[model samples]
Target: MKQSAYEAAVGLLSRRDHGEKELRSKLLSKGFAFEEVTDALTRCKEYGYLDDSRYCELMLRNGINKGWGPQRIQQSLKQKGIADSRIQEMFLDLDIDWFEQARVTAQRKFGSQVQRTKDRQVEMKEKAKRFRFLQYRGFDFEQSNYALEQLSL
Candidate 1:
């Protein structure tokens, strides 16, 4: 049985939400014509089944839950076809303190490593490793440093 583009789109959305651009790409890759994909997207929008703002909000919350920093979250949202202005607006409205988030993330990741060691060299190495992990998590130097400081306490 050949399913229509709208049917396929709804099926995909039933499993999870998707941004319009991602949905369109998936539909196109499934061999639907451009016009079919476009129509399906439009219909989905009309039904309020496809909302970029809702998708962005979900992604942002998911990123934070996963302990991802703003830089990484922004990049992920952009990849999902969210606008920079939208992302910035959401960020402004968010009450999260990124510095505190960084500190918490570091503590979760390296709590045991913060134990005092007789060897200053070992302590320095541990700090470096923690800093690198924070950086890889999209935290900037100041955020990472603040995290390291907090973890030391």
Candidate 2:
């Protein structure tokens, strides 16, 4: 009369997408044996129900919406157990244009005030803070610099 591990896994997956490691861990925590969890995971993969590539795409789209830069995206995916090789292949030549994105984000958060500062020291300090914010959003050094420069103009 016991429910199958596969059934439980399917129910969990139906609620939301999960990375492989996360799924496996959840099932194990729920008392499913390792073999059963592995079998269920394999079936999920066979049915195209679990795919890191799809996960990557979803993460990328979500990151774009949240104004996250490529470096942050890369780190996030890696944390989800996505392979480095796949990450490179998937993101190679990907151009998210962090500079322009940063400018837009800055404008939305702290628009003309950034440009209106007459004190050179205060202006530079504000600019540096803005640059740090963009960097924290996962942009690289060059992208952050370009974004801060564009905002000044």
Candidate 3:
């Protein structure tokens, strides 16, 4: 038997939280007609079964737990179709300190003795590598530099 649009949407939501855009796209991709998908989404929203803000908050917490930086998390949220204004608002309401998160991430990746070596050239190379790693992990230059300093001390 074919599932109704509402049934399919509920099934999907039962497994994980989804942003409205993501849920709409997923339902459409599953062969539901646009009108059916829209109805399902509207119903879901009305019943509080789908919420972009809730999804964003969950994603943010998960990203932070995984040591992701704010830039990286922002990019991920954008890719998931979250609005920039909402992202900014959510970030403002969040209590996380990005710099502290960066510092912890650096220590976790490089360890406490990250700067124990005394060779100037080798130390420079290590610092450069660490900086690059942090940059790639989505930290800005200032945040990366701060993390490196914290790791070195």
Q: What is the lDDT of residue 124 in candidate 1?
A: 90
Across residues 35-143, which tens digit of lDDT does each residue of candidate 2 receive?
9999999999899888777877887778878888888888998888888898898787577666787677666666744456568888778778888888888888887
- lDDT to native, each model: 0.90, 0.80, 0.89
Better of 1 and 2 by TM-score: 1
lDDT (C-alpha) at residue 50 in model 3: 91
lDDT of 1 by residue, 1-153 (tens): 999999999999999999999999999999999999999999999999999989999999999988888888999999999888999999999999899989888888777346788999998987888888988887888999998887763
Off by over 4 Å in 2: 93-95
- Please give, for residues 1-153, the per-residue lDDT of candidate 3 as tens digits: 999888899999999999988888999999999999999989999999999999999999999998889899999999999999999999999997788888988999989776466788888888888888888788888889888887764
Compared with the true structure, the alpha-carbon lDDT of candidate 1 equals: 0.90
Count clashing residue pairs in model 2: 0
| Per-residue error (Å), model 1, residue 24 | 0.8
Stretches off by above 4 angstroms in model 1 are: none
Model 1 worst lDDT run, 10 consecutive residues: 106-115
In model 3, which regions exceed 4 Å deviation? none
- Which window of 10 residues has the lowest lDDT sum in candidate 3? 112-121
